[model samples]
Target: MGAWVTRALRNFNVENRAERELSKMKPLSAPRHPSTKSLLQEQMSRHPEIEGEIARKDDKLLSLLRDVYVNSKDPVSLKVKDAGVLQESKEFRLPIGHHFEMMNIKSIPKGKISIVEALTLLNNHKLYPETWTAKKIAEEYQLELKDVNSLLKYFVTYEVKVFPAKDKKALQPK
Candidate 1:
């Protein structure tokens, strides 16, 4: 992992565990077509308005889920208050993609998340914090809105080819 990503993982207590699992996971297959190259793009194409949202709420959600699985030291007993699957599962929760999908976001791929994309999403999407429409993003993702807004922002920050609606040129100040 790159230095910055390693630093970013510091935000999660399960860095070691996630890293271990990630290391064991298979590498992503190359995209055959450029248009189909990015998951972020597919996500954005699904929910174009998601572009303007910030990453704070998504950070909060990550904190909460991490608290349950990592910080709390109860990876197995992590129970999400309103989550049906968490409620049903009697085992500690692992940082799996299921929850992210439920929330309409996803982790950047094993080697893809980087500083450049991070800046784009943070600077641009962060500008539209409360205005982000999760439902809209979710519709594009064909998934729930649990953490989609923030994830999309991250994807956008990384320049994942997520389509954007062309904004009208600003009116002249003259």
Candidate 2:
């Protein structure tokens, strides 16, 4: 009986140790790729000429963001004008002030998006207008007009529809 009990205890200990070892060996969830540094390295490798371009673009973007946050009036306020809201409307119906979701603007993937590209998308897409002209928008939101203008221009030039309806006289051919 003593021999049998000792053997059973030894077996149990071995089984538990094996289980712990296997647990440690179990595959971990695929590790997320470290994207940022790798992307910079890839860019430098494949397109060395673009390093300067990347830096310039980054400067402009940073400046614009800074201006919008620093110089605008409301800085953090969010609002919409009725006509402007129409700019983001689709032929189908959308809630009065929820159009910005059309282009997934909040999550634009990191890449070289031109102003025309952004404007075309935001204008033609089902965006909910959250900003007026930069000056007005800046005043209301406390963002700098330069930054807001850059962002707005990107949307305005490409997606003319995203712009608020021009007043009748303003619409007259200049």
Candidate 3:
């Protein structure tokens, strides 16, 4: 009876030791890759051309973002007026003032004037009708008359929309 009891105690001790060893065992894990920033830095250092490639890729991404933002925020339909393509309308409609959204204008130092500048010139002189002419805008902005005319034409076609009505006469205050 003593021998049997001693054997049972030994077995119990072994089982507890085994359980403790199992509990302390760590899981097998795969090796982890380097962080993204570190990997990119390593690649850039290894291959110098990668820097330029990255810059070009960033530029392309920036241009794509600009196009998306500009087109989505301020949508405009292109119209070829010189080709005589017009929307079907039986009556003329008055142009709504101050309805168009302001466009993003990029400033260029000592470069050709953009449509935004021309529009700004026209917008600045709202009180005077004489300054609204293309000639005046061209002279003020030091741009060619043709350039100013083209910008004005583009503004009228894109920014201003014509609403059609059944009556041709002007609206009278009732």
lDDT of each: 0.53, 0.54, 0.59
How do the residues 1-174 of candidate 3 rate in per-residue lDDT, one tens digit apiece? 999999898888797899899999697766556667688778878999976775565767788888874335433345455334543322332222332335433233331554455456656544465757878766665567887777666654225556665585866434
Any runs in candidate 3 off by more than 4 Å, and if so which? 1-111, 114-116, 125-127, 157-174
- Residues 88-129 of candidate 2 have per-residue lDDT tens digits of 562332222345556545422222333434454345333545
Clashes of each: 10, 21, 0
lDDT of 1 by residue, 66-103 (tens): 77844446554445554777445533322233334455
lDDT winner between 2 and 3, please give it: 3
lDDT agreement of model 2 with the native: 0.54
Better of 1 and 3 by TM-score: 3
Q: At residue 5, what lDDT does model 3 achieve?
A: 96
Q: How close to the true structure is residue 34 of candidate 2, measured as C-alpha lDDT? A: 83
Candidate number achieving the greatest TM-score relative to the actual structure = 3
Score candidate 1 by TM-score against the native.
0.16
